[model samples]
Target: MADQPEEVRRLLEAIDALAAIEDDATCASAVTALLNDWPTHHARLREIRQERVLALRDSGRTWKEIGDLLGGVHASRAQQIAKGLRGTKRPVKGADE
Candidate 1:
């Protein structure tokens, strides 16, 4: 991070947040820098997110449960990823799943 401009470092952390929420200036800056550093990783990261969601979903874990297991990502984010991976149907609704 030292090599990064001060603005860049702070934005990287901010972008990580935006990835899970909505985007804004900080996220845009961070994303620009991150892509400069690791363009190839985008696809890889997406694939992994999809894979993680699928693995946990197929194992019968709820979105909330998977999120908890996945270092505290929001349950909604977990649900979307998992549902996307499932390809046909979304993950079961409610905590009952």
Candidate 2:
């Protein structure tokens, strides 16, 4: 589609190339390598997204606007992300407490 990002297109092409591999062993090895490297790739993606969010905020976009742009998260949640706060997990409670 015309709206698809170039990076996404390239990723799809890479997946296609992987799917086209003929040798089972080679394909398995390639998949294994990708799995091993995924955490680094995922972290880089998070960094890029956070950078963009900060840039948007610096450009005077409101938290609500940023949240809408970020696929409908709440304004406070957007602000938390922009401020580098990790999402909080609820503490597990003991039954006796």
Candidate 3:
């Protein structure tokens, strides 16, 4: 969090607050809602990551370095993921239009 943007830090703090709920039924309901909407968030996050990966690639970062940053995924897989996301049209933040 020391290096993360303020928005990211706040979001994490909010999530942590939600996770700290003590009521059983409330927690269950919250978990249910999260699970129901998780796929949408998951997809959006993947799209964002793919855009970032492509931007990193364009900035001269090697595929291997990107793979290392992305949890040890192989360079080939990272390339494939980036290619797949090209059709999504989600641009990286602060990247060229």
lDDT at position 1, candidate 2: 45
Per-residue lDDT of model 1, residues 36-62, tens digit only:
877577667677878878888898998
Question: Superposing all C-alpha atoms, what RMSD in Å does each candidate have to the true structure?
Answer: 11.8, 4.1, 11.7
Clashes of each: 0, 0, 0
Best by TM-score: 2
lDDT of 3: 0.84
lDDT of 3 by residue, 1-97 (tens): 8887798899788788778999978987987898899999989988888899999999999999998887798888788778864334678888984
Name the regions of candidate 3 deviating beyond 4 angstroms: 1-16, 85-97
Q: Where does the lowest 10-residue lDDT sum fall in candidate 3?
A: 81-90
Least accurate 10 contiguous residues by lDDT in model 2:
87-96
Q: Per-residue lDDT for 1-97 in model 2, tens only? A: 4566898888988988997999999999998999899999987877787889999999999999999998899999888887777789777787458
Off by over 4 Å in 2: 85-97
- Residue 10's lDDT within candidate 1 is 91
Better-scoring candidate (lDDT), 1 or 3: 3
TM-score of each model, paired residue for residue: 0.44, 0.74, 0.66
Q: Sort by lDDT, best first: what order?
A: 2, 3, 1
